[model samples]
Target: MKIKNSLVILLVMAFGVFLFQVYKQHQTQGSLNKTAAYYNTNTPDEVGASNVVTAIVVTYRGLDTLGEVTVLFLTAMIVGYILRHGGKEKPMKNNTSEILITAANVLIPGSIILGVYVFINGHLTPGGGFQGGAIIGTAITLMILADPLGSVKKAVLHITESLSGFTYILIGLAGLLFAGGFLDNRILPLGNLGNLLSAGAIPLIYSLIGLKVGTELSSIIASINETGNKTA
Candidate 1:
């Protein structure tokens, strides 16, 4: 088995080296294609985003992003399945210090606010829905730790996740019907370039994504915590 593993690693390394050499050979002869130039130069005007990265991700490649979000949702479903068997466990008595609980209560609101800010400005700033969602998930973790007996509502999370996903799909369809193409940012009127309302549909889509992700992750965390209590 060790010999087989070594041979497999060697084969993979050699294949990677061969691919790298081929890429290097082509790199010298290749220049920026028309598509690349167009994406680089015209993305801002076309997508109405000061953040080129956001434009490419949520506008030019929106379908791929949606697919990725779907995969995450599937993962959440799997986690829910695993946690189902342990859901009968009663919540453990809270042992967290009062100070810790109070501090968490104070900070959770701020974390949620920060998460919203990140997703809302995704088209104009560095952060986006994914990052923002993770932040909100962290806040959920704090909430669980602060009061273990105060269970997070799985039903609420489910509703939030479903609504956000449905909204995202509706927005994509709207773009197809009303704009230049599917996931086009021009469906709604584009406001000022750097303003909060400038990037049509992108911000709304990202906000939905953030909410979906945050709720899914929170549900997963709740499930895991419940499972842990059963084992404990």
Candidate 2:
């Protein structure tokens, strides 16, 4: 026991030292001023987005964002596959109180509306596709809690996922064909900055992303809920 305690203490000391070294290194390196300045100055004109963060995410680093979405898609697919058999089993009855159910029903629509609003205004404001999708997913969670055994429209979710993903890829290909590079946000007219329809393909791409992510997360929620029902 003494030896175990000593080893634990040694490990903690080593971890603390490592963290201190990392902190010191980070302090010495400072911020990348040149890169920051360039993005700040050039992003507005080049991407035609009022929000530089949106420009970076939906335009400059679009491929990276796509890759992230792809990874999430794959994970969701795997999880759904693993839980497929659960759909055949009888569901455990929902036992939520009337007040809880009523609250969930009341809040779900508002959450979805807010989610859509966030993704729609992504290029003009602080929020974006991922944030909006998460909000929608939360609404789904509320619905599931209210009615655990209820079926989500699997066909609609699948279609939304497939269509959105296909459209995003097609838009990227179009960018490669017509614009500066792959996933370029300039395939269509940029229009006036801060407009709902402006920022070229940004709003469209992000809208697709929001829908895809929301549906994907909902599917995951469905799978988990079904699996829980089966076990119960």
Model 1, range 1-232, lDDT digits (tens) per residue? 9999999999999999999998888745366788778888987678888888888889999999999999999999999897778745664677899999999989999999999999999988998999899999999999998877656888999999999999899888898899888778788877878999988888998899999999989988887887877753
48, model 2: CA deviation in Å? 0.6
- Measure candidate 1: CA RMSD: 3.2
Best by lDDT: 2
Worst 10 residues of 1 by lDDT: 86-95
- What C-alpha lDDT values do all the predictions have? 0.88, 0.90
Which pairs clash in model 2? Answer: none
- For this target, which candidate reaches the highest TM-score against the unseen true structure? 2
lDDT (10s digit) by residue, model 2, range 115-221: 99999999998899999999999998898888887757778888999999999999999999999998999999999988989999999999999999999999999
- What's model 2's TM-score? 0.91
Residue pairs with backbone atoms closer than 3 Å in model 1 (clashes): none
